[model samples]
Target: MIKPADFDFHFKPDSHWQWVETIALPFAVPEANINGIVYLVTRPMLGVCMCDVTLYDKITDLWEDQLYVDNQQHLPCPKSLTEFSLPNGLSFKVIEPLKHYRMKYEGIDETSFDLEFFGLHEPYDCNDPNMDPLAAARNGPAWDSSWSGHYEQTYRIKGELVARGKRYKVDCVETGDRSWGSRPERDNASIIWWHAAFGENLAVHFFTKHDIAKTNEFGELVSGYILEDGKVYGITSARGSQEYRKSIPIGGQLEVTDIRGKTFEFTYSTTNCAYWAPYPAVTYLQSAMRVNHNGRIGYGIQQLVLSRAYLGRNREALLARY
Candidate 1:
């Protein structure tokens, strides 16, 4: 069982600790998607603490990401349960241990939100006791073991979002994910990450990690689950095939087989809401997609990230599409 203590910062001396918490909501009445991320990165050796808050608006295809870098010694590490205010008037407090979280933010612009997330499912640990989450490595020096741990859960979000002087009530399905470990420098890595949550008590999450230079030297990590009725099924393997137009992802199909040999197929289409992260280094393509699984209809997000240098010829194609 996961505890609220897992939400606390785990900064190791002389090492890097990155704690990221994110919630993504897909709304229908307003035909928009909203996502917020709180990132705290600590480097004890460097004595620095970097905090960031990112808000994404799918309707306007806009992204607002801000960063604050401070001395690690000045940043407060809450031992017990307490509210911590971040830069830009953003703060979060745990309302019900690991099951409920409340967040509020006031932006310099006329953008703000007061929201609560209620976990609908138990927390899923990406790395179990017998499994090595960072086992995917090349022949070289073991890839730094920076990606130490990851956990995620689906939630029901409720609250109000005030943007551009208008307030909109929010009631939708979302996902909360937390990952902590040393930050990997993505100079020569290629990645394919997939996440989906269906209304039928089902969700899918998986990723492919590889070296750009040696594409053959790669690993596929699967951490997916399916909930039907009151039973939870673990996805053992997932295979994905994508179609790209001018190097931009337009749509894709996925096949996930669980440990019980039950398979689910999903077909999804991408949206125009895309965001580029950290400027010229990374680009994240995310979409509020329509998903079809065995004729059952649902909605979710299809997101992808790629390093600039690793795209090669595909870079020109993506530029052309953009």
Candidate 2:
């Protein structure tokens, strides 16, 4: 369980040790042929924040508009992570520890939003001792370097967004994650993080250790949980792989079973995607996806991070094929 103290910054003597909180919200505007995502990452130790918002129109199959500010550095550090406003027009307040939060952003561009997140269940701790041994071991150094103290929760996000003279109502179910540990900028590792929700009662969040060079591989399921019928269950086993086209993820399928032996299967395809380089070597791709589970339509997001070293090593082959 996450304590109240966890909502505040956890700074250490080592400069590399840092705290991070991020929210990814996916929303749709009915009959507008538009779908979008709002993503924000805050790093108190570095005194910086990253804000990304993009709207994509299915009719054109292109990014209609975006407000992306990846480097907001050297700003004054907030005293507490739970409740504080940054100079860059970003503000966060916690209504309940590990359960609810309010986030707002007024960027220089025409994009801005005020959103509230309500947790569907208890936060899932990545460091839980009850995790499967094989999955825990597979996490290895990647977990040690950055994900040592990490927890993720699925939230029902509701708010409003205004962009380019248009207002859209936002109501969706997504995932938010927080972590504090030694995070180096240039680690040579790659991972796939994804979230899918069937409704208010069913949601899934997980991570897979991936090798960028192998485009057809499913990689290894390292950590995750399932929220079903108002209860949370640690994932016991999963079989899934992301489908890629020319090194870019287009869609994937997953069959995940929790500790209770209940299984859920779903597949997703991308509607829109945007790229960002948060760190020198960390190239990230965030996409809004349309999910289909048990023939029910739903919404979700897929985030993948690849290190520059992986690209540098496979540059020739990637260039030839892609």
Candidate 3:
């Protein structure tokens, strides 16, 4: 169970290091065959806040994305029961403690949404004993002590999104994750981060950390749960591989085995490329994908990050091999 205490900000005001809080909401409109994600991130230590809204219009095979960033000195502190608003009309508020949240945005670029998220399952703590030892160790104190804690919970989102004058009802399953404490500076070691929610019943989140020079020596951590028929099963272990076309991720397969030994295999194909944001050290691709989990079709987002040096080496190796 998630208590209100869990929502408290874990960083100290006097700490001059770094910290971040993010709220991600992904939804699909089946009737219209459209999918989208609203991502909000705040780096309190840097006094920066950003919101990225991406919508995939399948009928036209087009992606519309708006990214808004606020780097002012008066950025709101991330705390329980507080609100954050941007000049672009994006606002986030905690309505009912740890169980409910509201997100609204009125963008000038023909993108807007008003959504409410209600938690559907108990929060799964990444540090719990139920996690795989190897996975837990990677996120443990020895790996990155500044990574204080992490937890995630699935939510059923309700509301609407308007893109290009078309309003679509937002009714789907999404997950909200919180990771606090000191965040490391962007480095070559951060390879990729993946997240997906299968309706209201299952969610998966994981990431790989590896040195750019030695990809063979990598550590992966997996955390999530399966909620079916009112029972929750913790994800014990997960293995996945991505297949890419050039720099874009086209498809991939994921196998997640729960503590009970029931494994779910998912085959996914990209539906739209949301954004490809490049940083000094890494390039990130966020896209919506059509996922088939044991024949039950769904839609989710696939976010990938490749270090610049690693990407160069990968391309070189491919050329030499071919």
Best by lDDT: 2
Ranking by TM-score: 2, 3, 1
Worst 10 residues of 3 by lDDT: 61-70
lDDT on C-alpha atoms for all candidate structures: 0.55, 0.69, 0.61
- Model 3, 1-322: lDDT tens per residue? 3367666565567865566555556666655656666555566777665555556654221223423222233345444424667765667787876678888888765768898889886676666665433445553632354345666666788999887777788888765566666655454444545556667666655555433333322246445566665456776666666665544567778777677888888888876664444223545566667788777887666666565666676676644432
- Determine the backbone clash count of candidate 2: 0
TM-score of each: 0.75, 0.86, 0.79
The top-ranked prediction according to TM-score is 2
* Model 2 / residue 45 / CA error / Å: 4.6
lDDT of 2 by residue, 72-167 (tens): 545566667788787767788999987888888786667677888898877777776654333355545326556656777888888887765577
Cα RMSD (angstroms) for every candidate in the order listed: 5.6, 3.2, 4.3
Q: Candidate 2: lDDT of 184?
A: 62
Model 2, residue 89: displacement in angstroms? 1.3
Name the lDDT of candidate 3.
Answer: 0.61
Of 1 and 3, the candidate ahead on TM-score is 3
